[model samples]
Target chain A: MPLARRIIPCLDIKNGRVVKNVNFHHGTWDAGDPVELAAMYDRQGGDEVVFLDINASWEQRSATLDILTRAAEQVFIPLTIGGGVTAVEHVRSYLRAGADKVSINTGAVKDPDLINQSAEIFGSSTIVIAIDMKRRPTGGWEVYLQGGRTPTGIDGLKWAEEAWRRGAGELLVTSMDADGTRNGYDMELHQALANLVDIPVIASGGAGTLDHIAEVLTTGKADAALVASIFHSGQYTVDDAKQYLAAKGVPVRR
Target chain B: MAARIVIVDYDMGNLQSVRNAFKAVGYQAEISPDPASVLHADGIVLPGMGAFGNGMRKLAERDLIDPILEFATGGRPVLGICLGMQLLFEYGEEYGGGPGLGLLTGRATRLPDTVKLPQIGWNLVEPVAAAHPIFEGLDQPYYAYFDHSYAAADVAPADVAAVTDYGRVFPSVVARRNIIGIQFHPEKSSRVGLQMLTNFGRIVCHSRSTLR
Candidate 1:
């Protein structure tokens, strides 16, 4: 069957509220309550919801998952929880707590086997290989793990293939280089991995307008696009992106 | 009650996305890496996303291979996605030679660079058979997201459901009897994806009569 595309709204939560900025690498200003923010997207209508704990490090273990579980009970769509997820147990906790999928970025690069361990237990579909990337000073995109601190020499595209080979069901390719910038998605990164694996790829980074959504869907072959700034800032709703893409003749889950 | 879809959560596949896609539509699905729950569900989804041999090994290690084979062959409604779909075949050449469930007479193999090993992106999947129920919600020449290096070949002519064009026409969705498999992520394929899931839900609901 010909499957339609997904418009996913990402909620970067800090201190229990949605927050955003040009890039998370910079400063993040408070957006709003995560439940309220999530409900807004649910109303606007998104196929799935991704809630990332931007400050999970400073909190209790799995504080983010607890927050996600609380929010998930309220939302009808799928919720993918990320941030500070380092072990298989953490992934299990999220899945058991109600998260449909658990995303790992820093943890995956730190321990590449995290992908296998996750796929082995939770199944690859439940484990998302979240690649938080920044344009390296060396002129190529390098994967940054550990809250975007350590740079792994692995090329972004190679990492995507490797993750899939190691058994990650989906890939959340976020360009830390362009995250929250609202300029647009990192087309090069999106394009590279979009054609690399046949699995689902969620394109995150630089989503400021609906036109960028169309561009990523058409050019990057991304199954879904994750928007943070526009949705978090109330510039566009999940409906807005759906209408935008629909106007372009692309089918979206209404 | 709507069909209680059980997703087999062996490390062999992507199970949560399947459950999430169903739950998003208000359908109840449970994730049980355990086989007892898997065999008991009204309908089962084998949503896979990994190496084929290892997938079979995981199933074998958990003693799930035979039960799942019986479920698929015993007239239970089962849907397999990606590698899960590939595993339904007779065998695969991934990592090394591994025996498949042999539910369908075909083998999965890696595509050469000529067709781009992983035919990633949204491609137009053309249905080979007309009026198949699994593809009902999908639009004609609909777009489904795919990420894989291997493709199913030597499929039994009766099983090919949809043929998607990458560098060439390949089976995107295939079925035999009650078992159906899709190469695309119906969960992540957005609206069309949801439609596909809804169709599966419909099947699960319809199969409730026979399930008990």
Candidate 2:
């Protein structure tokens, strides 16, 4: 049989707490405990859970690790941690703290070699290069950093190709324009990136209805879809999204 | 006394999670690189993740190669998971083809690139044989988590316990006498995975008692 298209719930963590209204400059508001929400997602059959610590400090990173350590005990599925991860040691520490994988966003774009070195130490499968992008006014997507605050002017597709060549096992492409819009995923952006890389592409950012999730997997050719508000605000359960996708003949783990 | 299980650690990855899974099944498995501990164990759980070549180098670095071969040949139970399963075979093609422990007759090769690499997610595991100590209470077509880019190729049919597919049918579970290998993370695979571990635990205990 074919592999199931994964439904991953993303938890944007700040200072060790799950934050909902996070948009770079305005500051983040606490939503719930990171570990508790992760365990709940685990029980709800989230194929995987992503914990992105936005704008975290050295101390807050450790605190996030504590949450991951606690969550790993209860959450049986894979847990991926991101944010403030620039060095190889950060990847090591997070994996030790029970993250099955680590996503490198700004760090990778700046150093580039950081992706290769981390992949060498932790294995490519454990290293995910997350490309946060904003559609350029001219054309193409530009890489964004610092919680999507700063634009690096790096071409998203070129960077994704380089990251893959540097040994990134997966690519997490998030569209800043569509993020939190509830309009739907940036299918054209995700599809273009997904086509560029042979590795798994996790389509992230805008996720509204069950159709959005299904459309990204089928039309965008995303191997997995990541959603946040829909699952967090109790608008839809992970299972409901999964059942809807499965009924649409898109294979999903039930 | 409970069976003394050792989870061989070579810095491959996921060693702690593997130990936690065994612990959850009521076995206090030691995570050790010491050859003596491996030799003394009633059963060995070789847990690994990452590239095939790197894993072999780690085994050689820790001087675990010969001791593991001896333990497996000595008729004690041994279970290999994921990359650990691939390590049991004769060769692996991830990052270029190289020799493995050579306990099982096969080569681990990359899955067809048509499907996404690392093929992460749950898939059905169907037992090839009617009876095995590991399949205990599990029904056919049960889902187990899989996160792998490669699968064992040219394995002896008689030794394969279960098979799963991701663009192609590949061995999911293989067993021969006291040696067994599973290409999924039982710990991260939830309840059914724990149940499989429990069954392996029972096999360990039974083998220990019989030996005594």
Clashes of each: 12, 0
Error of 2 at B11 (Å): 2.7
TM values, all candidates: 0.69, 0.92
A15: Cα error in model 1, Å: 2.9
Task: Quote the positional error of residue A36 for candidate 1 in Å.
Answer: 6.2
| Best-fitting candidate, scored by DockQ | 2
> Cα deviation of A212 in candidate 1 (Å)?
5.7
What DockQ would you assign to candidate 2?
Answer: 0.57
Evaluate candidate 1 and give its CAPRI docking class based on DockQ.
incorrect
Candidate 1 stretches with Cα past 4 Å from truth are: A1-8, A22-50, A56-58, A67-82, A85-226, A238-254, B1-6, B9-11, B14-17, B20-42, B114-124, B145-147, B205-212
Q: Model 1 Cα RMSD, Å?
A: 5.8
Give per-residue CA lDDT, model 1, range B25-125, as digits (tens). Answer: 77888887777887777888888776898888888888888779777776888898998999999999988778899988899988765653455445677
